[model samples]
Target chain A: AAGVIQSPRHLIKEKRETATLKCYPIPRHDTVYWYQQGPGQDPQFLISFYEKMQSDKGSIPDRFSAQQFSDYHSELNMSSLELGDSALYFCASANQGLYNEQFFGPGTRLTVL
Target chain B: DQQVKQNSPSLSVQEGRISILNCDYTNSMFDYFLWYKKYPAEGPTFLISISSIKDKNEDGRFTVFLNKSAKHLSLHIVPSQPGDSAVYFCAATVYNQGGKLIFGQGTELSVKP
Candidate 1:
């Protein structure tokens, strides 16, 4: 079974730079979610989209924004990156239903210097 | 204000034994719960999930027991195998919220042969 896919499995950036992370959700999956996991911490919800529309938001920083494209793919854009932004970024997708069990991607490791 | 928590940081079990991982939550509005197994540098793999209306859900060797009154949930893996060693995360979310998951700190399970 094909799983969610993320681009640039590993990314390195400097402070005040900009970075963009892309996600290709599983086929037929209409909902996408983004999360950040810092060192020694659990995954934190960043934002989510459903049917190419912004559906919910979480603790995502003001410098970060995301949107789902017409093809059900999503991208997370981070500007003016800070060292604190270094972490593992994950993308998950699910078919909206009663259960809504999400399938996750391998994750992108972002290291900000 | 961590809404979800996994008190145990790690657990070791001999092969063929049962592995029990626990999780707790402080949010009453959370209507859905899930268990995920994750390996290093990979995304979380969904194990099992139980809705708030049910007390138990079983899938093969993995079973999830939910206690709504106590706001707690547990995952039991019977006949544990060495291949089952990984970090297990407990997650929850509110229904109709675009399926944004709130995850616990995770518990590492080591099944030794």
Candidate 2:
């Protein structure tokens, strides 16, 4: 099946520590997106990468950043992780032409203590 | 501000019954709408979608109805099964730029067999 893949299905980190989540888009997909879902809340867009460049960013803080490399693998890096930063992070891959449907990864649940 | 909103937090339905999930959006510019089903510990999977040009779209037993005048949409699942129990999320896209989906707080559906 054509689906995005994410590493480290779950992670635990301490406050003030840094964390990195990785995602590999489906083959031939050019647009990658990241979202954070907090408890009882909708998944909020964090940032989007297209052609290995940042195209749009959501209302997230600067402490959250995402990068897409040439290999089409993307990483979400959190600097100075705070307690509130704990949430489920999802990565998605989509072909620009097929913007209506985006296949998502299983997501990484991050817990900061 | 929340562009997409799912007013119901949870719904319970018996097997073989019809389940209706509702969503409302504040943005009139949004032209595309989609529904996703997310199981516990997994990312959401695409269910169905509809465009502004059409009022209804159907796939198998799932159907999406759009009421543009009211900026509202609904997902109907007929003959609901226990396997259909999951959190359902409503999402909308504006301008169709690489599928930047604004999502609503999901509604949990419990299909009782």
Q: Evaluated with DockQ, which candidate comes out highest?
A: 1
Candidate 1 C-alpha lDDT tens digits along B2-112: 899999999999999999999999999898999999998899999889999999999999999999999999999998999999999999988667689999999999999
The RMSD (Cα, Å) of candidate 1 is 0.9
lDDT of 1 by residue, A42-104 (tens): 899999898999888999999999999999999999999999999999999998783348999
Error of 1 at A103 (Å): 0.4
Give the CA lDDT, 0 to 100, for residue A46 in model 1: 95
Tens digit of lDDT per residue, candidate 2, span B13-68? 99999999999999988878989999877999999889888999999999999998
Specify the highest-TM-score model's number.
Answer: 1
Per-prediction TM-score, please? 0.98, 0.97
DockQ per candidate:
0.80, 0.77
Reference-based lDDT, residue A48, model 1:
89
